[model samples]
Target: MPIHIKADMAASVWKVLVEPGDQVAENQQLVILESMKMEIPVVSFSAGVVITVVASEGSSVLEGDVLVTLSDDGETG
Candidate 1:
């Protein structure tokens, strides 16, 4: 199974901390979003390997937009 990390609101991507093939733990920061002059950290929901990054740094994202995909470690195809 794959988990999607989505933007909670419209914002500019400040940074991407993890890339494809990187291992991430649950509640770990995946990316940072700048909105209203505030920086928000986007965290992962499950422990897994990063499969893809849909949003890049300096990119603007809307609410509910997918940021990254994670391949769950315990899941099987």
Candidate 2:
């Protein structure tokens, strides 16, 4: 299975903290978003290897938009 990380709100991507094949822990910051003059860290919901990033730096993403995908890695069923 795969885990999809989505943006919580509409914002411009400030930075991408991880790359494809990078290992990430649960709750790890994946991408940073800038909105309302504040920086928001988009977190990973599962601990696994990042398979893909759907958005890039300086791109605008809306709520519910897929940001990255992670392999399940047996962390959860």
Candidate 3:
């Protein structure tokens, strides 16, 4: 199964911690978003191998924007 991680709110992407082909665990921080002077960490919901990273640092992202994709079976995208 594949999972798509999305932004929960509109904000500037402050940092990205995962990349394609990286292994990620459940609740691991994938990206950080900055909004209204607050920093928010975006975490993974389940363990998986990252397939893609779409968010970039310093870019504005809207709510529900896809930030990362993951393959739960350890497959590379």
Candidate 4:
């Protein structure tokens, strides 16, 4: 099954750490968001392969927005 990464709060995307196809470990930082003068990191909950990154730097995102997707084996299809 695939895992969806969502924004926890409304913020501007600060940075994307991994691109699609990158192998990631559990708790790896995927992106950082800037909100209310604070930086928030979005992390993976388990080891997996990045499937997609829907967020770009400088993009504004709202809470619950889907930012990225990952699979346990790194395959999207």
Candidate 5:
């Protein structure tokens, strides 16, 4: 299955910590969003391999926007 890690709130993308094909563990930080002078970390909810990174550093994102896409074992097809 594909897991989409989304933003919980509207914010500017402060940093992107992971890239496509990176191995990720549960709770691993994927990106950081800065809003209202506060930095919010986006984490993976499940262990998987990053298939794509939809969010970029210094970009603006809205709530529920997909930041990263992951598959159970590095295979999305």
Candidate 6:
């Protein structure tokens, strides 16, 4: 299955911790968003191989914006 990880709220992207081809675990932090002077961590809901990183550091994002894409079966091609 392919998973699209999205931002839950409007915020500026503080950091992107994973890139395409990175293997991640469930609950692994993928990106950090800064809103109202607070850092919010975006985590993966399941283990997967990162296929794409849509959010860039210092970029502003809106609620429901995709931050990352993952392939649960470890195949991105």
List TM-scores for all candidates, in order.
0.92, 0.91, 0.97, 0.93, 0.95, 0.97
Give the lowest summed-lDDT range of ten residues in model 4: 68-77
Across residues 1-77, which tens digit of lDDT does each residue of candidate 1 receive?
78888999999999999988888899999999999999999999889998889989999999999999988974322
What's the residue-level lDDT of 14 in candidate 2?
Answer: 95
Candidate 4: tens digits of C-alpha lDDT, residues 30-72: 9999998899999999899888999999999999999989998
Sorting all predicted structures by lDDT, with the top scorer first, yields 6, 3, 5, 4, 1, 2
Q: Give Cα distance to truth, residue 53, candidate 2, Å.
A: 0.7
lDDT of 3: 0.96
Q: Pick the candidate with the highest TM-score.
A: 6
* C-alpha lDDT values of all predictions: 0.91, 0.89, 0.96, 0.92, 0.93, 0.97
Q: Is candidate 1 or candidate 6 better by lDDT?
A: 6
lDDT tens readout by residue for model 6, 1-77 = 78999999999999999999999999999999999999999999999999999999999999999999999998985
Please say which candidate is ahead in lDDT: 2 or 3. Answer: 3
Candidate number of the best lDDT:
6
lDDT tens per residue, model 2, 1-77:
88899999999999999988888988999999999999999998778988888979999999999998888774322
Clashes within 3 Å, all models in order:
0, 0, 0, 0, 0, 0
lDDT of 6 at 51: 96
Q: Give the clashing residue pairs of candidate 4, or none.
A: none
lDDT of 1: 0.91
Worst 10 residues of 6 by lDDT: 68-77
- In candidate 4 the C-alpha lDDT for residue 55 amounts to 96
lDDT of 5 by residue, 1-77 (tens): 89989999999999999988899999999999999999999999999999999999999999999999999866955
lDDT of 4 at 49: 87
Of 2 and 5, the candidate ranking higher by lDDT: 5
Pairs that clash in candidate 3: none
Extract clashing residue pairs from model 2: none
Ranking by TM-score: 6, 3, 5, 4, 1, 2
